[model samples]
Target: METFKIEGNVPLKGEITPQGAKNEALQILCAVLLTPEVVTINNIPDIIDVNKLISLLKNLGVKVTKIAKGSYTFQADAINMEYLESEAFKKEGSSLRGSIMIVGPLLARFGKGYIPKPGGDKIGRRRLDTHFEGLINLGAKFRYNKEDHFYGVESPRLKGATMLLDEASVTGTANIVMAAVLAEGKSAIYNAACEPYLQQLCKMLNRMGAKITGIGSNLLEIEGVTALNGCEHTILPDMIEIGSWIGLAAMTRSEITIKNVSWENLGVIPGTFRKLGITLEQKGDDIYIPAHTDGYEIQNYIDGSILTISDAPWPGFTPDLLSIVLVVATQARGSVLIHQKMFESRLFFVDKLIDMGAKIILCDPHRAVVIGHDFKSQLKATTMSSPDIRAGISLLIAALSAKGTSTIQNIEQIYRGYENIEERLKSLGAKIVSE
Candidate 1:
């Protein structure tokens, strides 16, 4: 039971580097199972969820060697297929959502993949139908055992086929792509998730001798190759962490430089914060946020309607950053509506913001309206419990900009995504201690 004790009213100033993307790391790590050769990965973030996945891989007999601080080499030359049916696997695989991705590569290579019911943040109903159905469409047999709460996919051999996903599900697309990369023929995926995470995975696979085209679009073509070789991959910056830093600077009136951010891949995140009237300077691959001046203001629509900040698929705002946007809006000069379309319960965190002396209206399970205080009324720090990874970071931002010291409990939820968050923020002059 660790908590973060934060002293507010301090402007964080310094250059901080964003770690590798968590979502991408999950997919990339699972892709290692597709080949028996050594796969060297750079810029791996040392976080809880990812480490858990690494442990799961080791349990299945993958040899993972530490190359450096944030680099590792994984070789799956001696995998134990029988371990997938063991109780240890059920206990390990069910802990994180990323474990479900292993099923695709294993099922494609070994003809059988089993996973316990995966667990993750309680943001909303994250369904596994997308992954299972996609694999089934690729000629794999699927089954669900309600008594044991497990999912199984088996196929002696997979044949590629055209399939349209119900939605552009990220992990679902990754699973199907991994399976399709080694199937008998070409596979066309329509309405697929074209987020940078999936694109990087595809690019990495292509580097490892898999045939995949349409890197940055909804329509993807994967021609099944006989075998894939191991290759090195360097992950892009964590976009969610970049957004969090932007919100943190605006909330605390800090002048912080986020170094080496993948500018082109961020996709509307920097511009979205700029719409809130925050000053953003993009120099080369870095983003520099200047200290606050007359506070922040929300830009109105062209037709003079109340401004609304919402999340959509890629090339649109990400749902993961909506919580940070909502927290940032509370300190802006004008009002804006934050709509989280993908996840329902993510908006529930606004209640904690409202209790901190901010004006907020909870419209529904997925929407909230925030009237910016614009620093006229500084938020008073109070004790609160973090509900999820994004909300935890958002609350940490609020606590940093608050009037007094604040405490956030259940920090393990925060550590699941952000690596050494308190230590990193403290380096930027933030007064945060974990205990």
Candidate 2:
């Protein structure tokens, strides 16, 4: 129920450190349930979703201890699998999309997994068909209560098999990989999502004695091990958060540097933003964003025209961040089209932008054409509520660049990903106060 009160038109300055990847941390936390060994994970973000997942893990009897501010040693030695059928489990499991991942490890370790329909941003129809299909191929028997939308999986001995995911879903790929790591035989996954988050999960599993090859490619071969041992690993810096900071700096004409950005893992993100004419300098592992004394220009196509930014699977522009990019495009000096093919309802926020005097054409539910007029900051600050994680960040960007003050309600949605966001932005000279 928290909200952010922001005084707009202030150029953010100073340096900020990126937090650990929320997506990666979720999978790693659940993977700990597969073994009783002490799993030491570093750089875990203090985000709402992670807190919720940790609470769920605790309820399942995992002994979680904080070794440092952002580090934890998880021991699932006494984890009780019966909690998977509890009402608390159902409520928490249905609260976040990442909860579905627990089904894989739980089923593999305990021979059964129960989960309710997972909830997340209502951008579009995010089906769990790929997840269930992959697990079924690995010898899992699924039972669903259609009336209640609850699902259960059981298999005495999960035997790995060849899995060709119908689509390259990020969470789906991670679920399959977790289940396959402890299965009975080698599992080959083709057409998988090879995002950095998934790669991080694979690496952690390997460190725990899981044999996984093709780390950065779609074709992954996982050799199921008899048991995985405890290992210490650090999560990667969140690329999406780095992208958000880049967009905020560009929109507010701020000079900021994001530290510890995994430069190599950020494929296509830098290039995608370069289309907006934002130049980034990489000094070792850090990214430097100069003060926008001169605003950015949108790049046009071949002979002379506006360009378009769209989303796809791995190695493509991340769908989760397209909303942030769209808001940034509004401040540019040219026209650009944003095609959100993955989510039909994501473009619904364009109405709010249009109300702020942004010239946007909602071509449909899946696309929007923004003609950047660089309007003299006519945005009249209004009271709005955040809808999702990425959209919430976009609204923050929009509010920060507006003419007057704006209040964004339901900031808990933003906190579900970004850690101490208001404090972080405040350190960068953003006039944002949370209450």
Give the candidate number with the greatest TM-score. 1
Model 1 C-alpha lDDT per residue in residues 1-435, reported as the tens digit of each score: 999999998988999999999999999999999999999999999999999999999999999999898899999999999999999999999999999999999988889999999988999999989899999999999999999999999999999999999988999999999999999999999999999999999999999999999989999998998889999999999999999999999999999999999998999998899999999998999999999967988999999788988888887899999999999999898899988999889989888988899899999998899999989999999999999999999999999999999999999999999998888999999999988
Report the lDDT of model 2 for residue 417.
90
lDDT of 2 at 394: 94
Badly placed stretches (over 4 Å) of model 2 are 375-378
Task: List residue ranges in candidate 1 displaced over 4 A.
Answer: none
Best-matching candidate per lDDT: 1
User: Against the unseen true structure, what C-alpha lDDT does each candidate score?
Assistant: 0.94, 0.89
Clash counts per candidate, in order, are 1, 0
